[model samples]
Target: MDFTYSEEQQMLADSLRRFIDTEYTFEARRKSARQGESLDRGVWNKLAEMGVLGLTVPADFGGFGEGAASQLVVQRELGRGLVLEPVTPSGVMAAAVLSAHGSDAQKQEWLPAIASGERIVTLAYLEPTTRYRPESARASAERSGDGYVISGTKSVVWHGAAADAYLLTARVSGSNEIALFLVPRDSKGLGVTAYPTIDGLRAADLSLQNVAVPASALVGQPADGLAALGVGLEHGIAALCAEGAGAMEKLIQITGEYLGTRQQFGKPLASFQALQHRMADMLVQKELALSMAYVAAQALDETDPAARRRMLSAAKVTVARAGRFVGQQAVQLHGGMGMTDELSVGDYFKRLTMLDQLLGDSDYHLQRFGEVMEA
Candidate 1:
């Protein structure tokens, strides 16, 4: 199979790359990060104008992409800049959930806002007890007259504090089935504690006590919601894989540059045969991760759910391992300066570390991959 990007895909990638280069300078990013919002609305709006925020939204709702291919391309670009925006969560994850499970009216209302970057939406799936899967969720939604009352806390909601709305995951009353609801951020009995993540992005701890929503807030069927959640996660992992690839590439670039500039023992560090071997290994890992990212993106369109999960798990494992190796080598090569926050090398290292923890780590997915193979 040909691995080259289509003209449209290449165009989208080039457009995004140029935007990152010209607008997302390290200093600008450093400033925004210091202010506590890893993402600026102005930047997000520009991304929206570029049609990147709606890459996965259904065309009926004003989105354009070929499966997950285009998204992978955009994600790679965003990753290169260590972008703070919650693009994958809001645009890819939320959009995937809405398109796959929402009512037509719901779609009409939310998709346009998201596409235009007029509103931000985030998915709150993991509870403190939740481990990538919602199996440990203690969050519950009890049925009421024409409505449901949500009562539980969600931990580490991606961009939750800044989002206009949250797609909450709850266990339906008296059943093991999963239920999803769209809760407005200003809803009564809702609270949030926003904090900076290790990677400079913001995440929130959400508190919900008797927060109520109309039955119309329900997304898809209770039984089917869990399945849809899986699909959303698969899309998220694909985006993460691509982003991880881009970050890995950047780490390789930065390390290579650092070695060239930093002199050691009366000669350039790049001249050391040992370090040269290390840099070569970093490049190989990055390329391997990129190839797996490509596979994960394409696998999203697979007809069989089992097959899709297997591929995503495998790719996640590959990306995680490669990411860890690249991050460590990058930091080690840079020495003490690499660990300092002032430099981008350490920041990239932090992002890579967090990426491993998010959406399940390498060991978690490796086990999942084994489970799939067993079945």
Candidate 2:
């Protein structure tokens, strides 16, 4: 399959890059990080005006009527900019989930606002002990008079505190089956505590004490909640791989420029043959990672389960390895300044570290890859 970006996609990327460079510098990111809040409303509105927030929403819902590839392009640019916006949660995860499983009424109610970036939504799937398995959720939604009462705690929900609504995953009463509920953030008995992550992104812990929602809130078949979650997970992994590839590219570029200008023993550090070889290695790893990311993005719609598993696992593993290598090498080449917050390289390192852990780490994907091969 052809992986070359279309002209429109390239133009979109260039526009986003230009805007981010001019308006969202590392200093701006640092200020936001220190503020310990969700993204600034003004910047988010600008993104909406740029049409990025609606890249994936269907046109009928006031979106651009794009697909996963378009979303991937936007995410890659966000990564390159070191942006702290909650694009993955709101754009990819929540939007994709709603598009795939929401009833017509549910779609009409939520999609327009979400597509316009007037509303932010987040996924509440992780439990205290669930680790990386969406199916391991123990949160229960019990049938009540005219609706369901949900009681559980969700850990590390991306943008949970600032979200207008939550896409909650819970088990149905008396069964291992799973379901998703669209619970408003201000619902009665819902408690939220949010903070900035080490990488400067917002995350929250949610406590639902018998929070209730009408049956219309449920997305997809109750028993097929796990399946819907799986689709979201796959898309998430693909987007992450693309983001990692972009990070790796930035790391390589920044390190190269630093070496070219920094002097060692009366000569530029880039004059060293050994360092050149290392940079070459970083480039190779980044290229391979990009290839895997593209393949995984295309494979997300594959009909065969085994093929999907294999491609996604491969993409994750490739990204993890390349991300680690690029981050470590960038730090090493930059000497002491690489670890300091004043430098963008250090922030890149932290962001890449968080990406390494999100969804699944390197070892996790490696094991999954082995399993696919064994089967």
Candidate 3:
């Protein structure tokens, strides 16, 4: 299959890169990190104006409806810039879930707001016990009069600090079936503890202690919650792989430039044959990762769930492993300064490290891939 970017995709990539280069500098990112700010309103609005926030949503809902391929383009640029926004969670994943399963009224209400970047909604499915398995969520929702009361704890909700609401998962009371609910952030009995992550982003731990919602809050059939969550998870993994590949690619470029300029023993580090070989290896890993990202993106269009999941697992494994290798090499090539806050290399490495742990890690994906093969 051809993985080349279309003209529109290339245009989007170029546009986002230009914006990041001029507006989203490393120093600006550091300032936001120091301030403990997760979402930069100015930047978020600009992204919306650029149509990036709407790239994945259905066109009928005022989005570009560009799908996974466009998502790959947008994510790569965000990764290169080390952006702190919640595009993956709100713009890509949540948009996909809502588009797929939201009621007509829900779509009319949420999709336009999401595409316009007026609101943020992140998936809140990960629990202390779920361990990356949405199906294992034990949160329960009990019918309360004309509504339902939900009780659960969601950990490390990405960009939850800025979310106006959450697309949460819970088991319906008296049944084994999972259900999806739109939990507003202001709901009574809901608790949000926000914190900054090591990668300079923000997350929140959510506590829903009998938080009540109207029946309209339910998304799609109560029994199809896992399937709804799967749409978001799969898209999220693909976007993340693309982001990691971009980060790896940028890290390699930065390391190469550092080797070319930084002198040792009266000669540039790039002159060392050993260092050159290592750079070559980093390049190879980056290329492989980029290819794997494309593979995952392409797999998003696959109609067969098992086959699509297997391919996504494969891509995740390759990208996760490659990210680690490339990140570590970038830091090593930069020497002691690599870990220093004054250098962007450290930040890139940190982000890449967290990316491996996000969604599912290399080992997890490898095991899942094996399981799929066995099955």
For lDDT, the strongest prediction is 3
Cα lDDT tens digits, model 1, 1-375, are 345789988988898888888988888988887799867989999999999888888788887744687888889989998999889888988888888889888899999888888888888888887777776678999999999999999998988888999988899899998888888899999999999988888999999999999988888877776776777788999999999999999878888888999998899999999999999999999999999999899788888988998999999989988998999999999999987876799888888889888888888898989998999
What C-alpha lDDT does candidate 3 achieve relative to the native structure?
A: 0.92
> If ranked by lDDT, best first, what sequence of candidates would result?
3, 1, 2
In model 1, which residue pairs have backbone atoms overlapping below 3 Å? none
Q: Please give, for residues 1-375, the per-residue lDDT of candidate 3 as tens digits.
A: 455789988988999999999999989998998799979999999999999999988899999888777788889889998999899999999999999999999999999999999999999999998888888888999999989999989999999979999999999999998999998899999999999888999999999999999999999989989889889999999999999998988888899999999999999999999999999999999999989999999999999887898999999988888988999999899989997887899899889889988888877888888888898
TM-score of structure candidate 2: 0.97
Q: Name model 1 segments beyond 4 Å from true.
A: none
Candidate 2 lDDT tens digits, 1-375? 456779999999999999988998878878888898658888888898888888888898888988767777887888888888877888777888888888899789888888778899888899999887788998999999878999999999988878999999999998888998899998999999998787888899999999989998888888978877777777788889888888888778899999999999999999999999999999999899888889878877788988898899888887888888888899999999887876789888888889877777777777877887899
Q: State the C-alpha lDDT per candidate.
A: 0.88, 0.86, 0.92
TM-scores of all candidate predictions against the true structure: 0.97, 0.97, 0.98
Best by TM-score: 3
Candidate 1, backbone clash total: 0
Task: Give the poorly placed runs of model 3, Cα more than 4 Å off.
Answer: none
The deviation in Å at residue 357 for candidate 3 is 1.3
CA error at residue 34 for candidate 2, angstroms: 1.6
Q: Given candidate 3, what's the lDDT at residue 26?
A: 89
Selected candidate, larger lDDT, 2 vs 3: 3
> How big is the positional error of residue 38 in model 2, measured in Å on the Cα after superposition?
3.6
